[model samples]
Target chain A: MTLEAGTTLPTQTFVVRRADLVRYAGASGDLNPIHWSDRVAMAVGLPGVIAHGMYTLALAARAVATWTDDAEVLELGAKFTAPVVVPDDDTGVSVEVAGEVASVEDGRATLRLTVTSEGQKVLGMPKAVVRA
Target chain B: MPVDASLVGRTYPPTRPYPVSEAKVRELAATTGADWDGGPVPPTFPILLAFEAMNAFLEAEGVELARIVHGDQKFRYERPLRVGDVLTAALTVASVRSIGGNDVIGTTSEVRDADGALVCATSATLVHRGGAA
Candidate 1:
């Protein structure tokens, strides 16, 4: 696939339930209670149990992998601009990821990503560079 | 308590070598709703090592896990991680500042292979919420 500049990749949405966070906590070894315990989250001034920022960022990487057929990622980064407050319901919340190829040069494609939860941007300057 | 600004530039000891296994990669990929077919591991997989290094840094500094929130993260890779690559992470305090009663601490962790070759360099910004005094 020729990812030319200004190319828009297909948008992908991923559900982030509490169970997923628990699994992510175990998988990533981040065992921080703020991701699972609502009481601790509130005591720490959070809205409630929040998803791990790396978990959300992982979803973003999953999207990129789908777009590039799992191309080797040269760089990936983002800022946690907002919390993805996950509810106790089974449905949980959804995080939407959209990307546009900003440039394609030097055998690498730079993708500018927009990641959101509940219609609010959750990552500041989320971006990735992958082998084209 | 605010994180000491003097902690900047401090480098923590490298973590013990962590063996990368296919099952571990599959576990991490499964959490993100992806099936690992034994291909390249997920880009964010190195967080396993980085978080370990960060936890040691926080523990030695007496920082509470609940009071800290992730603020930012970045990863630059020398190569994609493969199964059987035993790795270690050494963390360095990159920067520290206060904002709205929160200590925003910047840290960089170098993930290296068994040969001590850098595989990926990941950076994180942790926001520590100040407790009620």
Candidate 2:
């Protein structure tokens, strides 16, 4: 993929359900109850069961891989600005990831990503640097 | 409870070595709806090691996992992680501050290979919610 400055990559949407959170907890070893148990999440002042921050970030990484054909990721980072509440339903919620090539220099492409769920931005300053 | 300010700059011991296997890589990828074709592991794959270090730190400090929420995370890679790489993460408390009765703790973990070569540097911010006043 030829990434140039100002190029917008295709947007990707991921459906996050309660089952996915359980799978992620096992896979990543997070096991934070807020990510699975609605009772614990509510006790901690969360609206309901929330997705793991790393899981949401992983969706962004998936978008990067799709855009770059799994290019060598030199850097990836993001701030968890808001909680993505995953309801206990089959359909779940949709998290959308969109990116634009901020710059490309020295064989690297810097991407600025916007991740959103429930029409609210979920990640702050999500960005990735990949070997082009 | 707020994290102790004195904890800043304190580095914890390196975590146990984690062997990167293809099954592990595939498992993480599947969570994100991706299929691992045995190429470079996903960019955020090192979080498994970092999270383990954080868990150890929290356990030692008597912090409850249910009271904490993730605030931020960042990863800078020296090279792509591949299968068969055994890695460990050494964590350091970077900063601590209180905001609106919540303790925001900052930590940075260095992910190193078996040779102790830095493979990635990952930083995370954890927000510990205070009990009712």
Summarize candidate 1's per-residue lDDT along B1-133 as a digit string, tens digits.
6478999999999999999999999999999999899988999999999999999999999898888899999999999999999999999999999988889999999999999999999999999899772
Give me the runs in candidate 2 sitting further than 4 Å from their true place.
Answer: none
TM-score of 2: 0.98
- For residue A128, model 2's alpha carbon misses the true position, in angstroms, by 0.3
- Among incorrect, acceptable, medium and high, the docking class of model 1 is high
How do the predictions measure up, each by TM-score? 0.98, 0.98
Alpha-carbon deviation at A49 in model 2, angstroms: 0.5
Model 1: CA > 4 A from native: none
What interface RMSD, in Å and to 1 decimal, does model 1 have? 0.5
Task: Give the clash total for candidate 1.
Answer: 0
